[model samples]
Target: MTNVLILGANGQIARQVIAQLKSSKAAMKLTLFLRNADRIKDIAPADSTIIDGDTTDTDALKKAMKGQDVVYANLAGSNIEAQAKDVVSVMDALRIKRLIWISTLGIYDEVPGKFGEWNNKTLGSYIQNYAAAAQVIEHSDLDYTLVRPAWLTNKDEIDYETTEKSEEFKGTEVSRKSVANFVVHLIQEPNLEVKHSVGVNKPNTDGDKPAWY
Candidate 1:
């Protein structure tokens, strides 16, 4: 069985990922790590373990990462760089190579046209933090895949497309469910796109902003 640890387990995307892991036939030993233990009591899978602690806490992270085959991080916020640094450090110490990280789409200034302009103007430092987090992961020796998702929505549909970091990103909005599906796919197929940054978005929904905006 593949042992997987998920940080930021209480997050919306992470919750979806947990549900997918539970229902899939993949033989996975899942562990959810969050700041609040109570937040995941009811949502975690029957066979899964849940640990509560800050991601920036190295000791807690080291303990949570023990014997894990892969680590998936669904984290965000202004302090994201510090959190990513801790995760990378612990994973490196543990000699765990596989890491799947969630980042934002506009971090590389990859969002084209008017939407790109608006996103940069609106996000300001938030996107900068994400970019820094991505940099920390990239500089690490760990085998990593960074997923940059477009503006996320609560829609249940799974329609989405992807672009490599070197390619021009497409579309404006993608459902959280769609991003979760992609992450689960990576878990099931770890070698599919190792050491790459990929962008996920709804197909053909390109515009100055997401339809909702």
Candidate 2:
């Protein structure tokens, strides 16, 4: 069985990712590392392995990260760099190279136009931390896919596009559901998503980065 370690399993993206994972091939095993076991238990797969602890606790995280084919980080906005660094270190020690990291668009000045300007202002502090975290992953030897999702929306739909990190991506926004589905695609395809900083957003969409969007 392919054992995969998922950090920050309690977050929204992680939650949606878990749902998609449930329908994946049975040869896969999802081990979720979360701080709150109670809530995680409530929604996680019945067959999934669960680890309750802090990511900063290197010993604990390393223990869970071992013997896994891939590790996906869905960490919160606060202290993202530290969490990502810690996860990367654990993966490094274990020699686990496949990484699926979730980052926001515009982190590397990839977001374009006036929308990019607003995205920075709206998510300035968090974007910097995520940008630094992306740099950390870039410099690592691991096979990584830095998914730069546009303004995350929690819609029930799954229609979205995967762009080539062009200037047009800065203004494009995607639904959380679509990103989750994309994660599942990456998980199944492996290196297909490797070494790429891809962007996800709704197609043919443009204008003032919708506040309600």
Give the alpha-carbon lDDT of every model: 0.93, 0.83
Best by TM-score: 1
Instruction: Assess candidate 2 and give its TM-score to the true structure.
Output: 0.94
Best by lDDT: 1
Q: Model 2 Cα RMSD, Å?
A: 1.5
lDDT by residue (tens digit), candidate 2, 135-193: 99988989999888887787899888876654457345678888999988888878786
Model 1, span 58-108: residue lDDT tens: 999999999999999999778999999999999999999999999998888
Residue 5, candidate 1: alpha-carbon lDDT? 97
Off by over 4 Å in 1: none
Question: So what's the TM-score on candidate 1?
Answer: 0.98
